[model samples]
Target: MGKKYNRVLLKLSGEALLGEQGHGIDADILSTYAQEIKAVQEAGVEVSVVIGGGNIFRGVKGATQGMDRVQGDYMGMLATMINSMALQDALEQIEVQTRLMSAIRMEAIAEPYIRRRAVRHLEKGRVVIFGAGTGNPYFTTDTAGSLRAIEIEADVILKGTRVDGIFDSDPEKNKEAKKFDQITGDEVLKRRLSVMDLTAFTLCRENETPIIVFNMNKKGNLKRIVVDGEPVGTTVIWD
Candidate 1:
C-alpha cells in the first residue's frame, strides 16, 4: 500500500491478451482484461497501452528463407494492428472509451501516430492503445512502448509479461532460476537480461522512466500495481 505514482504507460505482450488457450483474444479473457483496465482508469490513472504482435506473427514465419529483414518487420507491425483492434473492441464492449492509434498511418481503421492527440485522449480519461510498432521496420513493440511513453510523459512503464518479473533464467523452463525483487537498468544491460530489448531499456533509462515488470495473470494486478504500489513483481529502476 505504498504506491505513489499515477498516469503510467502499460505495455502488454500480445500473448497476455490470450487468456486460457494462450493464442488469440478470448472473451472471458478480454472481459477480464477490460475490468482490470477499468479498475485502473477508475483510479484516475491515465493509461496508455502499446501492444505486441507476437501472438500472430513472429515476422520470420512469413519471411522466405532469404526474406529481407525489413519486409518481415513490416509484416510484424501490421500484425500488431490486428491485436490492437481486438483490444479496442473489447474495451468498448465494456463501456470503456478507448482509441486506437497506429504508427503505420492506417487512417482506415485508426488515427495515425499524433503525439498531441494521444496525450489529449489520455487527459480526457480515454485509454489510447498504440499499434503498428513505430511505423517503421526494424523496430520492436518494445521500442514502440518506449517511444510512446516518452511522448506521453508517463510516470513509469508497466510491463506485463508471462512471468512475475525478471529472472536469471526462464522460470517456466528452469527449475532453479533466480528472481530479482529490485534491479537497475544498468544491471539489466550489463547482465544482458532478457526482460526487455536493449533498445527499450536504454530509451526508458535515458528518459528516467522506471519500469515495473510484473505478472498479468492475476485479475486485479493492474489496479493493484497502480494504487497499492506494493509491486506485484520486480521494479526496474535507473540508479
Candidate 2:
C-alpha cells in the first residue's frame, strides 16, 4: 500500500516509556519503539516526536498537591527532557540518526529548538525529538506536539496511547464505552472529548491538522497507519 502520511508528528506519553513497569523507562519498550520507528523511517516517513512527562512528573498534578504552578511546570519540562534523551539514545543505538531539541535551551544536553533547523533535520532523514513542553508554563506536551507539528508542516499527529482509539467514555473504567472509527474535530470539541487539552485541540481544529489516536504499544500498528493506511485508530479531522 502507498504511504498515507509522508511526514508526521508522533506524540507519546512518558508513562508509555515505562512499559510494564510503574515508573521510568523500560529497556524492552524503548527497544521496541526504536525498532518500529526505524521501520517507518526506512519506509520514507519523516518523523518528529514529542513525549510527555507524566510518568516522571506532571505540573497539574503537582499543583493539585500545593506546588507553585510555574515551578511545577518547569520541573515537568525537565522530566520530558530526560525522557527525550533516553529515546534519542535508544533510536541512535538502533542506527536511526536523531537530534534532540529542547525548548528550555539546555545546550549541554540538547540543542535549542529552532523551527527551520528542525525541518532541515527532517529533510536530511534524521528523526527529530522535541523536549521540554514548549518551554512555557500552563501548556502541555500535547500543545507542544500540536505546535511543533504545525511548525514543521507535518501531515498529521499520531497520538500513540495505550488505548486503541478514542472512546465515547473511558474504556478502562467502563467496559460499555464504545470506540469511534472516525470523528469530526468539531464533534470532539462540542462533546468535550478529552483527546487533548482545549488549547491543543483548538490549535489543531483551527489549523485543519488531522490526528490519529492509536495503540503504539502494538507492534506493526505504526506501519499499518502510516504506510498501509489501515484504520487502526480513531481519526479526528475536519469534516
Candidate 3:
C-alpha cells in the first residue's frame, strides 16, 4: 500500500483477541496485537480501534433465548468493556500509550468518550480504543466503527475479521466461494455481502470512508494489511 493512508480505525472483534480454542483472552494473542499496533504507531500511522464483544456475548444469541432485546444489547455492550480493558492493558504492557474511551462512562476505568480528546490522543501518537458500542441499544459494533471513523476523521476503517476477505458464499461452508479483492460499497450491499451490516456500510458510503475487511487471525496480518495492501481482502468504498 505504500502508506496510502495515514490514520485508520482498526475494528477488531473480541474473538480476534482470543487465540485458537477461543474461550478466554489469550496473552500471546494480546502480545502479538500490541506489537502489531506498536510497529504501526512507530511507523507514524495513527490508529484507533473499536472492539466487538462477540467472543463473550453475541447479542442475538441472547435474544434468541428469550432475553429482552434491549437487555441483550446492554449485555453485549458490557462485554465490549471487558475487551476494551484487555486491549488497554495489553497495549500498556508493551509501553504503548493508549486511551480507553467509553461511550457510557465508567470513570474508575476509562475516560468518557470525547471526540476532541480522542483525536488529540491519536495526534499525539496514542492508540485509542472506542468501547461500549455507541452507548445505545440496537446498534452493532459495526456502527460504532463507522461513527468513530467519522468522528476521528480516519482515512479508512480496517475491520479486522476472521475471514481472508468477502466471499460470494460462506467460505467455511462452500469451498468454491469466490473472494473479492475490491468492490464498491453499493456492490457489497447490492449483493448482500458479508462485509458489514447494511447500516454500517451505508454510513461509510455516505461519508466516503473506505473500509478494508481482512483476516485478523493470521500472524503478521495487521502489519501486512497496512503495508503490503496486496489485495489482502475485500475493500468496500465508493472508489
Candidate 4:
C-alpha cells in the first residue's frame, strides 16, 4: 500500500541496455525501462539513476588493447552520456519529466552536475539521470551511483541487474549457488561476493546505505520492490 523507499538511486549497467542485441541498445528494452521507471515515479517514488558505459566501451578493456587508460575512461564517460540522452528522450516521449546531469561540463547536451540542483529536481518530482561516471578515471559507474546516493541522502540504492538477486557464486555458472534474502556489508566482503567494486562498496558501508539487487528485466519487479514493498530481491545492509 505504501512505498518502501522515499528516494532511491538506481544503478544499472550499460551492458543491460544491450538486451538481445550485439553492440547497441535495444529499443524494446529502452521502452520497457522507461515504462517501469514511469510506473514507480507515478506512484510517488523519487528516482535518480546512474548507468554504466560497458555497452559502448570499457577503459580497462581498451587499456589491454594499447589505449591510454585516462583517454579511454573519458571515452567511456561519453558513451554513458549517449545512453543517458537516449533514456531521457524515451522518458520525455512518454511524458515523464527528467533532468540529465553530467559530471563533465556539457552545456549543450546537459546541465552541469550540481548537488543542490539535483536534489531540488528530485524534490520537484523530476527523475534525475546522472551520467559520466564521477568524471574521474579508474572509477566505475558503481562508485558514481554510490557517491550520488549518499550525496542525495537517498533511502536506498536499488541495483537493477539481470539476476534476481546476489548469490554466493555466479548464479548463471553455478546451479547450486545460494541466494541471501538479506545480508550484511561485512559478510559480503568476508565472502568476497561481487556486488559492487570495493570502492563503491566501502562508500556504502561507511554511509550505512542499503542496496537491493534485483532483476530489472522482469516486468513489475521494480514496482514490487519500490512501491509494493515486496521482498523481490537481495537486500544488503551495513549492519
Q: 2 or 4, which is superior by TM-score?
A: 4
What TM-score does candidate 3 get on C-alpha atoms? 0.92
> What's the residue-level lDDT of 3 in candidate 1?
45
| TM of each candidate vs. truth | 0.93, 0.95, 0.92, 0.97
lDDT of 1 at 194: 88
Candidate 3: tens digits of C-alpha lDDT, residues 49-151: 8999887774347455887889888888989999889988989988899999999979999899999999999999999999999999999999999999998
Cα deviation of 174, candidate 2, in Å: 1.6
TM-score of candidate 1 to 2 decimals: 0.93
Candidate 2 residue 136 Cα shift, in angstroms, is: 0.6
Tens digits of per-residue lDDT for model 1, 152-218: 8999899988688999888999979999999988888888888778788789988988899988777
Residues 89-145, model 4: lDDT tens digits:
999999999999999999999999999999999999999999999999999999999
Better of 1 and 4 by TM-score: 4
Model 4: CA > 4 A from native: 58-64
lDDT of 2 by residue, 105-166 (tens): 88999999999999999999999999999999999999999999999999999999999899
TM-score order of candidates, best first?
4, 2, 1, 3
lDDT of 4 at 190: 96
RMSD of candidates 1 onward, in order? 2.1, 1.8, 2.2, 1.6
lDDT of 1 at 27: 72
Task: Give the lDDT of residue 53 in candidate 4.
Answer: 86
